[model samples]
Target: MDTPSEPGQPTRLLFLGEENLADGFRLIGFEAHPNPSPAQVEQILRQLQHTHDKAFVLVDEALMREDIPQLKRVRREGGRILVMAVPSLQGPTALSSDVAERLAALFGTATLRSE
Candidate 1:
């Protein structure tokens, strides 16, 4: 959690995933962490809900299963941190993303796989 940014400062961007992705995100100015555990993710989300004015958090999709109660609560609470699941470097991910689901719902599943 951090103090509200000055009038000119940009909101923080955080990425939690494998080292390869973390390195790239760091190059682009995100506060990146490599291979964070589920507990750590919960802690970060909880902290963000309480203090920061706003942030962008990209999580390793494989690490977060939507069923976790803590995660569900954080999302439901409408925190300042915008949390999103992203593809990780660890093999193929079985996890699906909200964006993908929404796109499929809007355009139909056939359109998604057609590309």
Candidate 2:
């Protein structure tokens, strides 16, 4: 498990998603911003993509549906940023299903089970 950095250190992990999801990350010590609009998410991505200390960005998959182009650009241009789409509190969306399929293909086995 990764421990939180000491005070004054640049943030390493960031979460932008539903309030409930963001709160979950906050509880784990990540810097989290809840319920940002797509535009706001884009702005934050632009600002943080170049920051040397930024490592990971966890965003709600549902939110990305509104601004996929921006997300793609960030993924393509962000040399070190690991942008991950996560399911919201409401449960899995199309993106999650796609991801699961891709992972299953990659690993040659079922990666997720449907309820």
Candidate 3:
């Protein structure tokens, strides 16, 4: 980890999404941004851009299509700050996860169960 303020500090994990997911992530030690506005999201992204520490930012799948220019630029640039899209806490939407499908393929239907 490397930063102007704190050299050799530990890498960070971030969860930028809704409140439902934020509380749980915060408890697990991730820096949580619950239901942030577009501007706030952009600001955070900009801040992360400068800090030269490896980090994982877990963004809600729904926010993947954010119209923020900074986010668009970050996605286009592709840096050490890894970004991942996860499902919302409210459950799967149109952008549903394929976890069930993958699990079924690996373990077979008899071993898979639905909620």
Candidate 4:
């Protein structure tokens, strides 16, 4: 689990997805990583989990399908990290229904749509 950020510190926003997705977030001032592999995502998440700052991670939903356990573990252990699985530029994956339900339950919102 990560330590909490100091009072008034800016929360970090990170996006992990494809090149186009990373580029889109980068244009909006967010730090983005273009990682399509689940192994790489797991490694990065492990490293980021120990940082003493608030982290909002937006990941490609498709990749999440390949490693649901890793994503679940991160959500279970990451105190200062919030992970959100979002659709890629190519659109939502076939696992959208399951992912959307879980995300909605986690965040208590029904605004997330696969389409």
Per-structure clash totals for the candidates: 0, 0, 0, 0
Q: How would you encode candidate 3's per-residue C-alpha lDDT over 1-115 as one tens digit per residue? A: 5445355667689999888988999999999999888898898988888765567888786776678788777766776677766776565343322554577678876555323
Sorted by TM-score (best first), the order is: 1, 4, 3, 2
Task: Residues 1-115, candidate 2: write the lDDT tens digits.
Answer: 4443445776478888889888889999878989998888887877665444555888887776675566778766765567777875565444553466688789755445433
Model 1: per-residue Cα lDDT over 4-101, one tens digit each:
65666577798977778889999999999888877777777767666644788887776556455556675556555677777765565444566777
Q: List the residue pairs that clash in candidate 2.
A: none
Model 2 ranges with Cα > 4 A deviation: 1-11, 50-53, 96-113
- Per-residue CA lDDT of candidate 4, range 22-108, in tens? 888999987888875777788777766656667798887677667556667877676777887777667544335455678878975
Provide TM-scores for the models.
0.70, 0.69, 0.69, 0.70
RMSD per model, one decimal = 3.6, 6.4, 5.6, 4.9
Better of 3 and 4 by lDDT: 3
Q: Candidate 1 has which clashing residue pairs, if any?
A: none
Off by over 4 Å in 3: 1-8, 91-115
Least well predicted 10-residue stretch by lDDT in candidate 3: 91-100
C-alpha lDDT values of all predictions: 0.71, 0.71, 0.74, 0.73
Better of 2 and 4 by TM-score: 4
Error of 2 at 61 (Å): 1.4
